[model samples]
Target chain A: MRLPNKTCAMGATIARINDGDTVMVGGFGVPGTPMTLIHALVAHGAKNLTIIKNDANEPGMGIDHLLRAGLVKRLITTHLGLNAHAIGLMNAGKIEVEFNAQGILAERIRAGGAGIGAILSDVGIDTELAQGKQIVEVEGKPHLVETALRADVALIHADRADPFGNLGYVATARNFNPVMAMAAKCVIVEAEAVVPLGALPADAVQTPGVFVDHVVALETLTEEYAVVER
Target chain B: MIARAALEIESGMTVNLGIGLPTKVIDHLPSHLEVCLHTENGMSGIGPTLPSDRADRNLIDAGGAYVSTVPGSAFFDSVTSFAMVRSGRLDLTMLGAFEVGANGDLANWKIPGKFSPGVGGGIELAQKARRVVVLTTHTDRAGKPKLKTECSLPLTARGCVARIFTDMAVIDVGPEGFELVETAQGVSSADVAAATGAPLRIPNTALPSF
Candidate 1:
């Protein structure tokens, strides 16, 4: 339960940037997210990063910044159509990614958190998503079964957090945070405000601080989904 | 029968009219009834019959196909719109029927011959809804009846249809059975049965002409 209040664009800020790392995202199309940590990652100058999330970030918010920054090289997500940057990079062969359906991505993240080996959902069966994935015959039929996932890092956003780092999701942004908390090796929280230990309610806590390794604070929340025209 | 069905359709009915013949129901509006159209992906208050001129690239149906946005329309997400459909909050949904047996099995989502984005949202919409109204031509092109003894195609939903409105006839699906409610202009009950691919029971005094 430590805070790493790193400034953007500082070379020392990027020492935490790791390669082949997976960041569990917390945002429903830019509504709720830790824009500071995300930009720090960009300033951190990481490359060949693998992102686990629902969709490719868009022009003004979410992971679209990363895609625009040309820092990320791969993504495991549901849709690439939304983020034109990611799609363009992929089309240009600058990045590689595995696209999944919305439900499949959610369940895979859940399976990883649940500590189960894998799930046998046939949502993407008999199609491209099944190409390299396992196909277990359940009563003599091919099922495009998905495997469990474990991330190297969980980068999440929290509504309120104590000094100890236990947190709650503000609203609909809570969709993936709880499940993602258990799916990663290291959890980093980027909170708008950081408070004293035990400041957050036990019932309100969605992702406990026991999982958080780092916390970055924002002076005040600002719209971070803006495209980096500069 | 048309008057009776009109009772179920109140003003401000937000409906998702299914593809094919059911798409024609927009024309059936009484001119006074306010029906707001919702296309999946996120559009409420869809415009009339989008063909070329009205095709708005920014506007799309819930299925992620481009559609025309009407004068007063709002676009959200395809997921949110479908949530409305699956949540059983839609007032009424008019669907196109391929086959509806005495058991009320549906087969509009798939043809089973080729790869279509089969059963995208049909299963959820047809399976659970407050009211289900189907629209189709009563007979097939070969003089075979589209209404069959059993669904030859894969079923989308089972035992959920309440009423059926076809070009040649109107029928009600009740606990009692397939009751003929109306015969379209210049169509007979006997001709309606003759066109059907299945054996149908016609209720007496219900030579409904809507």
Candidate 2:
């Protein structure tokens, strides 16, 4: 018995993403951002995108290009402190922005992958984040129901991958990628290195191949993937 | 203020230091002190911040500072990283705040039209940490008090702040409101009271200086 290969060209997979799609981009700053895939998405020119990412990468990098291209219509994220452009767009009402408590965002994505409808928590009960949320009384305490978030496509960056799409993410870069991979209908990954099926140890895999639909091996990591000067 | 706040952290506690002022507290901790430093970006046992030349592209704190991992450091996805925060595994979390109300209500994440960098992990850290302290300037740049009778800005969490370490004094949120814990050297209790927006409860004893 042989496992199927999921390797494919980046452009083709990204091309499948249509306008007005909800796309989950896995990253916490530069570490796990799929820069090459993002660039391909920019060239693919799908407009009115609702992007879910941790942060809008600093100016001229990552999703900023999509924002620059005026492709993003909405962004569901935890923070946008680092990107003035994103804030400007949000402030000007050019794009819609929904902020979540960081952990709740992760839990919502995880719940989506787990086939749950929502999870209750007290993270932001009395705050503005709870303004529109449905509250339920659980064991004498009020809990806000954070709905699960599922995306049409998820873009991931991995340190290593097997032809079967088993992924290994390095250090802090592992954040969001593994979970986002699980929460999307189509999970597309770009890896620093893609080796043979047995190359990545099974136990070391952060994202199993079954969650992935396509894996694109980076020929050379662009400067965007390097250690940021800031 | 940082050096004084460092005293709050005891050995064997897991601490999460917010991005700005609180992050500097790590530098003042004694070398012999052993605490597990957790970063919301999915690392615990955080090591020294590295120079860019020696930095690892894959490793960084939640603030995006290049950091190294200590011996027992472990990495997980965002879900598990936040699970530690929401589950109260974090012993102490020192956050930066725009305002702290007399009742321990914290306002930090949003300043409305002026500044609204959406709340990241702040709500969880403030709401779930075993002890939530704040490290901030006593006053804004315009010289208005940050320890307020009521927060004018939006709150990050309600009744979450335990203590506040400012440049002028150490204040605790007590049942009676902001109580003077200690004063900075050369700073008078009267001066602290004047700087505080809320009525300050100064004890009768001579206040210790940090």
Candidate 3:
């Protein structure tokens, strides 16, 4: 179904927090994500968010604010290398974190996009990985590794977006955003620049706005995040 | 020869075991030694076993899927997983091999008609681990031994593999060349030589049982 343009203006756009949530922030190490929306969620005081990301954004950066606010309950991410807030939270036993190998993490996102229930792998077999899990022996040897994952809401960043929710990303910003867009049930795209419908090029559009369910022009990205110790 | 190979594995060793032959070490490790398994995905201090149920359907190993937790298993996210490998927390990494150079460069990831699922922090393990072990079946499906001067498959890591353990012989990838450390119990060095595709260095020694 075609969606109407909803401004990402607080309660107007982001209505309520839902279960089985997955937000895909752009950039690898906390560069071009939708910081505005992340802060919005922090202000909105949402909880039980199951974030799907590449890295934990660093201090005074993207998701660090929410993590600091204690809003994120669970995280399914590739690396939590940068965010000190995450380290404190995990060490303190306040949050739940699930680890994913980089490439397999990407494939899990893609698997969700394709609507496949699970994908079998040979990556982690006969090791600590096969623990507490199924090891199907076929033809006198082990085969088929199955991982199940999917998402409900995908939050992304784009370079240019149309009112109808078509979107494009800039530079290395295309890392996990496009795949998350496909994997999510509702995609909310935050753009630096917003144009009318049909402005973004067909091929150049990394994540087609058609996948986007919400859009709003970000005012500016110059704010120095005021992170308070929780 | 078994003593020498056992020297390759010592007590309190943090081992990074590859699939295939390296997995056999689980059965052979001396009961007194404490060899922790540092898989690329996460989970350390692993014991030798697999549990029976999918209690946690979301938990996965390096490849990403539900895996049984061992007795002494501990869980952490990805950052610590890589840190354990990259920060010298692991003493040894028993790698797999597709091709091996005279100087011990190893390739084990890419294979024909098989999907490349993930690399899962192996590069760091190769670069940072104290000792590297290459464990693989001696020959391909066509009976050609995988030992070679250079790798033909996609390189997972470089300049790190030290020893080679196969179903045929336990060889060492030394600076000089592929040295035969030990052969399988039922096989001769000559039989291994005929089966292997590459020229190797084998000092006269009895085959060691793993």
Question: Which candidate has the top score in TM-score?
Answer: 2
* Docking model 2 quality class: high
Candidate 1's TM-score reads 0.55
| Candidate achieving the largest lDDT | 2
The TM-score obtained for chain B by all candidates, in the order given, is: 0.83, 0.99, 0.80
The candidate with the higher lDDT, 1 or 2, is 2
| Model 1 agreement with the true structure over B119-149: per-residue lDDT tens digits | 4445546755568887776765556677766
List the candidates' TM-scores in order.
0.55, 0.99, 0.53
Q: In candidate 3, which residue ranges exceed 4 Å CA deviation? A: A1-10, A19-26, A136-144, A223-230, B1-210
Model 3: share of real contacts kept: 0.06
Residue-by-residue lDDT tens digits, candidate 2, A1-230:
98999999988899999999999999999999999999999999999999999889888889999999999999999999999998999999999999999999999999999999999998899899999889999999999999999999999999999988899999999999999999999999999999998888788887889999999999999999999896
lDDT of 1 at A156: 77
Location of the lowest summed lDDT over 10 successive residues in candidate 2 chain B = B108-117
Predicted complex 3: DockQ: 0.05
Q: What ordering of candidates by TM-score runs from best to worst?
A: 2, 1, 3
Number of the top-ranking candidate, with DockQ as the measure: 2
Each candidate's fnat: 0.00, 0.94, 0.06
lDDT of 1 by residue, A1-230 (tens): 65443223223433665876767776544434556667778777677788876566566566777877777777776555446667667667787777655545556777787789788755535234456887788888666678887888777777666656677654234545666766887777767667766567678676767766666565666645322222
Per-prediction tally of clashes: 9, 0, 13
